[model samples]
Target: MTAEGKILPIVIHGDPVLHNRASEVEEINDDIRQLVADMHVTQEAARGVGLAAPQVGAGLRIFTWEFEHTGDAPTKGEVLNPVLTLLGKVSQEDPDPDSETEGCLSVPALGYPLKRSAHVRLQGFDVDGKLIDFEAHDWFARILQHEFDHLNATLYVNRLNPRWSKRWKKELRKQGWTTAGNTWMPGDDEDPFGHDAEAANEAEES
Candidate 1:
């Protein structure tokens, strides 16, 4: 699994693994370090800013992130069993269901307008089992929240505005998605993203 072409594939929205609460990592051993490294490789392949353990079909509370945000270089690292504390006031800008939104590697084609706390304080450990704590803002903060959601078995789709949510459900139905328990699964659709790729591209540019 450490070799090229062995990178784990990202589990999609309909996958049951994405809907279950991930178990906390009890220790940071060789296996987890490899998993983290593999996740980074997988995220890079998918062109994603962040990726969670569950997204790779692992029920572990861990995630990897790499994105540029006003620092010496792109903030890159892995957080195991992270705990996030949101800070600062909520932005006054209302969510525009079809505007600049966040997309997920699991839910390939759709982007959803979501409002999240502008700043967050994260407390977690690194691969060495050392304590790692920091405060994040703006895009970094958003990334933290997004990946954190995955640890709780939630997706960005769960944060979509009512209008966009309705539309998303409609599109799922059109794609033949059926609800079972707490999650929806796509059926026979080759391209789950469909037309949402354009919107997702726009979001990336901004």
Candidate 2:
């Protein structure tokens, strides 16, 4: 949730900002600082791992994830901003390739199996701008890719194989996907933010 305690709205498939590249964050100013904190609170409240600024309707290169919080949030957590993330030098060959199922807060109900590097070393800072480093394997590396995609206006949906894509379409339709092109519908899951569930309702109505 945001500082106002209203849950931050999530920009889903049809949102324009989710398709265009995000702007680079120029300064770690108070607004940017507040963004990281807001993303953390919002993501936790939404039960998400990592969230980018674009997901929250900001067209800037800011995202937050907790290396420590695998599933729980606020319970034990540190919210990070990528501005100071070092993403250390791990050569292409240094990390092994692995595939795993992945999902997004932006595209709920449709998770697809995708490949990613098995390990990573990242340097960044928490919401307070305190320096932090993240060394992770498997799922954690996947988290890095997921969060980074938000900066580039990419979604895990783009990574789905043809087989997975077909399966996703069928299932998402069952979950109420109405947009004919590249779009997704909110599943039966609870949406803390009103937009997704409302979108789902609208899709079904039309």
Candidate 3:
């Protein structure tokens, strides 16, 4: 996203960036809230629609997203903790078989096709940390997954097309992620993706 104003460039694998466990969120104050806003700005600036705090190095289980969904009566704009809103009502109505494409602010320029439940129920809170829930189906589901992965220290490539996953490897390496000091290599049984996104992200999380 916006690299200016603390919108940090997404850190990729092997940079000692993605490989650390994120700190649990204990307080949600102006600084935390500002970080969320900064993440959104960075996400947009990176041409991605979603971002997470850990991806920016804060290592918190938080992220944000904006999406375009096709379902029921057309609810618009960005909504967090959508379980309290129309995001969960999608299953009640016919949605145009949701198919979606997404990219992450941290996994910069890595776009891929990801199939999700299309309908989701997410619970979190606002800037003030009030409990909130929201839901959405189809396209919104895809967007939600992309952003949520950041919170879990996962990435879009974990569930996206393998071919795209391969592309992302190149992108990751292009961003300075390589197998060189890796604790395990591709052929190793512990290495996932056969050493792809699955193993890579797992490595980071571990």
Candidate 3, TM-score vs. the true structure? 0.61
Cα-based RMSD of candidate 3: 12.1
RMSD of 1: 5.6
lDDT of 2 at 198: 74
Q: Model 2, range 8-114, lDDT digits (tens) per residue?
A: 66766657788788886666677866666767777766767777888888888777766553432232334344532324443333222233677788776556777
Please say which candidate is ahead in TM-score: 2 or 3.
Answer: 2
Deviation in Å, model 3, residue 116 alpha carbon: 1.9
lDDT of model 2, residue 108: 63
**Per-model TM-score versus the true fold:** 0.80, 0.66, 0.61
What is the number of residue pairs that collide in model 1? 1
**Lowest-scoring 10 consecutive residues by lDDT in candidate 3?**
184-193
User: How far is 155's C-alpha from truth in model 2 (Å)?
Assistant: 0.4
Best by lDDT: 1
For residue 13, model 2's alpha carbon misses the true position, in angstroms, by 1.1
Instruction: List, residue by residue over 77-183, the lDDT tens digit for candidate 3.
Output: 23233232234332332222233555544443345665556566667665556664656666666666656655555666665456656776676666675532322
* Sort order, TM-score high to low: 1, 2, 3
Residues 1-206 of candidate 1 have per-residue lDDT tens digits of 24232366667677778889999998777788888888877776566789899988899999989988874323998899999998977665768556448888777767778888878888899877888788888878889999999999899888777787898888667755343332212322233445346656899999
- Give per-residue lDDT, candidate 1, residue 66: 92
